[model samples]
Target: MNQRVLSGSDLAERARRAIPGGVNSGQRSIPGLTDLVITEADGARFRDADGREYVDYHAAFGPPLLGHNDPDVSAAVAEAGRTVDLCGVGVTTAEVELAEALVELVPSVEKVLLTSTGSEATFHALRVARAATGRRLVVKFQGCYHGWHDAVSLNVISAPERVGARDPISAGILPEVLEATLVLRFNDAEGVRAAFAEYGRDIAAVIVEPVPHNVGCLLPEREFLRTLRDECTRAGSVLIFDEVISGFRHDLGGWQAISGITPDLTTMGKAIANGYPVGALGGRADLMELFSSRPGGSVFFAGTYNGHPAVVAAALATLRKIRTEPVHEHVFRLGDRIRTGLSEVFAGLGLPAVVTGYGSVFVAYFMTGPARTYDDLLRNDASMFVGYRRRLLGHGVFELPLNLKRSHVSYAHTETDVDRLLEAAAAAARAQLADGDVLADVADASTMGGVADRC
Candidate 1:
């Protein structure tokens, strides 16, 4: 461990006694990062319990797009807290306004339902799909994570042995649930067409991440996204865009707005409320209508905090900022700056690396060039990737020191922030390339990507 990051060592030790693996989430427990307990996050930087300041590229796994503790969002939340409280009966004014904003912004959403987490949004979306179509099977792609529900939790971050196998990331998942999900490869248009051809009638929905951020980033080909949309439409099965990662981060209207391919349903979260606990499911009115509180309605929807007033206020404030400010433009420019900067640094060092990102997120795969699929990512130098990120952490840059995880830039980041991050990353790369022995010490947990298995 670096001597600079040791201030949190005492708190980390105490946390291990209280929480399993010393953190609340699997991603938080990523080896080197577990020791860091972030005490304050504001704008583009956060401070660990050690009182060490670092530019935040992790961004709480792709939230805080407007930056942590934005004054507007925080004020909105505070006002909502003072004015209103949860009733668990009918909708709040903030909820209705937020829904209307989502409908206006998101191309595919005619009606919207709010949930507390992306996982719940996806779960309810599938339930509605099944109820509307009376089908048992759902289709998802390899490495495209649509949250941790039984239906779509299979075949994400699969190891080499389980690439083509029925690789459920968790053990307690029901066999029937795994069997119902037909996992296909991302960008494999033929595979998608074939799945629809064979199981069209039985398929309830086909959910996909327009950009598969789970395995770093698999930029969807136009043909692949069109195929999923077309096949699902032809088969009369629902097409779901699980844009939990891509939703409000890439565009105000989401990736669907950028690609011009809309799905029957969409799941949104993470950047939607910029770090607030807000998740939404929305789509064609006819399909969304299937969920009801009435006894006869096929899909049931109930949540005590579905659209908590404060959460909706935060979301509304975030949407307001994106709609009015140059958020996407700034983030995209800085994202490009960092990506190009890292690529040039790696090039100058004569390292084999492929730099990739979409909009505000970026990744450095220490292996082949132009990776498009999980199979390609399997070739990345796991040791080198982990080691480089660990070195960056030591140099005051914070990315999860793990393989195939992407870093994000927020609206609060400035040109100077980008420049500093580039310098730290270049140093990390040079240090790793020069001293192979240094990499053997990036903590013991090397499991690639999964929920419970990361630490």
Candidate 2:
């Protein structure tokens, strides 16, 4: 552990005594306790309790596109708090403002339903789909994570034996629930078609991450997205694009605008509120009509914190900045610079890497070429990635802690930030390449290996 990061060691120690994993979120808890204890964050930098600062490429796990604590969003939240922050039984102006802004910002969305987190938004979306279509089955692709709800959590990560098959990754999710989920390989149009042909009539919805970013930032085939839209419409089932990570990231309208396809339902979170706990499900009017139907017909979606006014104000402010201002374009331009810099660094090191992204979001994958599916990402050498992460952290560059996910750049990052990140990356890559070679030699020497089990 770095001595500079030790100021929060006591805080973590106390947290472990109460929380299950010494942290509220799994991703927040670094695997080896190497992360700084973030005391405060503003713009593209976060400070530890000991006052150590680093360039934050994770961007609070792909939110804060306007950077942390943007004055407009914070002021909006603060002003709204002076009136009312939550209205469990009544609607507030903040909610209406947010809904209006979202509808205006996202092209395919006509109506909006708000929630506190991505998981709740997805759960409500699934329930709304089932109620609207009069079906029980939900189809999802492998490695597309739509939060932790039981219905969409299947096939998130499979064991090697279950790699190419559909299997639930957790217990307590009944077999019947798993039975209702049809999982297929991502980017495989034929598999998608076959599943629809067999069970489309019973499927309530086809839910997916337009960009499958859970395992890695794997882009969907253009034709596959179009086919999904066509099939869901033809089958009379709702199509859900879970754009929690992709919404307002690549473009203002999300991957839908980029892919030129429209879904019946779209779930967005993460970046919408710029790190505030807010999420939304929005789309076609007829599909959303299920939520307000008759007593027996209406999908029973209720939450104490759904459309919390403070968060709504933040989201409204954030979306307005993206739409009315040049923040999104700035983020895109900076994202290009970062990606180009990463490509040059990786290529110069003779490392197989590809930096792929559209606007603020991108991934530096250590592979020979682009990864189009979760299956392809599964084939990547994660050990090499872990080594790279460790080396980068040592050099004062804070990237996403997971090899399964990559870092993000925000509008707050400057050209100087990009240069510093590239320098850190080049140094990390070189050191990791040497470590990788040494590990390969050690593996060759050991006689007792069938496979290395890494979780």
lDDT of 2 by residue, 395-422 (tens): 7778754556657888788888888888
Stretches off by above 4 angstroms in model 1 are: 1-7, 294-296, 441-444, 452-455
* Candidate 1 local lDDT, 122-169, one digit each (tens): 899999999899999988888888777788778887778989888987
Model 1 weakest lDDT span, ten residues long: 446-455
RMSD of each: 3.1, 4.7
lDDT of 2 at 1: 69
Best by TM-score: 1
Model 2 stretches with alpha carbons more than 4 Å out? 1-6, 292-297, 437-455
Model 2 TM-score (2 dp): 0.91
Give the Å error, residue 361, model 1.
Answer: 1.1
Highest lDDT against the true fold, candidate: 1
